[model samples]
Target: MEITILKSVIIDDCTTHRTVLKRLIENHPDLVLEGSYRNGIEAKNNGCEKNADLIFLDVEMPFIDGFDLLESFKKRPQVIMVSGKPDHALRAFEYDVTDYLLKPVSPKRFDMAIKKVQRNTGTMTGQSEDEHIFVRSNFRKVRVDYGDIKWVEALGDYVKLITEKKNILVLTSMKAFEQKLPENRFLRIHKSYIINLDRIENFTSTEVQVCGKQMPLSRKRKSRLLDALGAG
Candidate 1:
């Protein structure tokens, strides 16, 4: 499938960071950097649709941070939080960003995250469907049916997978899981939580009840979840 350019914005306080990010966006076949801002105030004052398709944002900035700017937007966009430190990753996930890109971002890592977004973009329009994910378990590789996943939670460098009757913890980044799982079926409700939509029994703006457990629901992901349910 041909990936289309999505309306995008970049917000960072560092000039070098902006330059690096701009290059990455320009290199991507499916991303268009709409504007670059030094801080949240500039982005907020521009008077454009706060509902951008994607946002490459810095975690710490003068005047207002990325998190504050995200709150100001009436309709939050798909956010990819950019940070220079690993400590803020948990906070980034609390906002349920699309992906977290560490400083000095690698082209490979950036491309991987973009692919996940592209897949979701396609699924939103009924263009494709992915049925399973391959994982390394017990010193061997195995395929896990997408439907079998109940919920996934981050555990440091790995993620705990809860399936129909099994709980498996794999040593992998949550971003890997995000990329492997189909977005239409799996939604990231919080930094630590990703749940299968079919298995969801109840959910509020702040939490999703799945497998009889309540997972956090952040403002960043709530709109997307509602839209997914509506589309389904």
Candidate 2:
């Protein structure tokens, strides 16, 4: 399979945080660092969104806050808001951001956020052909039958693909898996989970039982899940 490298830009006022984020982006195999700006003003003036698919933006910046900078963009890129203050999370969601991370972001959390971006981009691009997908497991390529997957769980930098007789760990994102799987057979019921619809044994408003394992269901996704099952 060919790799899709996403162009990314960093807009933050703090030098230390910016440097750390730059390193993280550079280290990711799927991301390409395009530009780094010290403030939102500079980022906006340079038309960062025009050339980038992803943006790591700071909520609080020196002149023209992150929100204002977003407003200025005619076409917005996928944004991951990095802020010291958690209070901006609610407002950030209003813009339908990919994810919000508090300052001093951990590697695990950052990886999760990037997964969200990858998934969102996949939806925009289009879904893959159903049947099977090739995944790397145990340092070797493995072909997973879509029908055999019971559910998928998100790990920090990888996803656990659970089938009836085995659990395969792949160095990939949940969003990436969600995109590859046939939508008719799978549904994302939570941020960290995507279950094979045929494997569901029972479900409630708050949880789902699949392969004798219960997984939490997000309230926001409950209605969508029901609709997918033709129960809504």
Candidate 3:
């Protein structure tokens, strides 16, 4: 399975810690460093927090402390608290954070924290338009809203995601990519195609049209597709 590419931001008052965390995130394949802020105020004012799917947050900072910063978010994303002290671990849990990373974070521990984030982002499929998944394309994380996707096409070792905004070619097998979608919303109509049920304008016995393109609908899977579309 492909790791979900997280849109990540760092908030730390210490220049040294911020630099270190930034390097680690940049080096990891699953993380895409969106921005690095010296303090909570800088992070807030820049509007980086709103767009981020994950935050590598420092528990102690100027202007607003880490706990206070968590409170400020109208909608908080997955937060991995990074602190120098072990004392705040219990208090941080009350906020329902993804994980807590101690300062001078080791690479091994960092990866473990990431695994939690992956489980949350990967397995859970949301049924609303507000929900989204990040796909790796052109060596960057591209966020695609559930409502925007029209279909997914199998392309050898990769799958081409056809969306309303743009087409993205992700380095993952079709069977693997199919698992990321909500089964009730998406149906595999053929060996080569999985179409968004909401986007279907019309279809025939042999083919279905999506995003103005005719894609082959294998006979074997057509009954399953029909059942999915007919279901509530």
Q: Write the per-residue lDDT of candidate 1 for residues 1-232, one digit (tens) a residue.
A: 4446787888999999999999999997678878988899998898433646888888899999888887788877777888887556545655666676777887876875675565545522233346677788667777677767889999998898898768887889888878888665788888898888656665666888786898889989887775554311
Stretches off by above 4 angstroms in model 1 are: 48-51, 123-232
Per-residue lDDT over 156-176 for candidate 2, one digit per residue giving the tens place of the 0 to 100 score: 999999986799999888888
| TM-scores, each model vs. reference | 0.58, 0.56, 0.52
Best candidate, lDDT-wise? 2
Candidate 1 positional error at 122, Å: 3.0
Question: Would you list the rank order by TM-score, best first?
Answer: 1, 2, 3
Q: Give per-residue CA lDDT, model 3, range 27-114, as digits (tens).
A: 8887899999998888899986788999988998888999998999997888888888766765665576777777788787687567
Q: Which regions of candidate 3 fall more than 4 Å away from where they truly are? A: 1-3, 123-232
129 Cα displacement, candidate 2 (Å): 16
Candidate 2 matches the true fold with a TM-score of: 0.56
lDDT of each: 0.76, 0.81, 0.79
What's the distance in Å from true for residue 150, model 3? Answer: 36
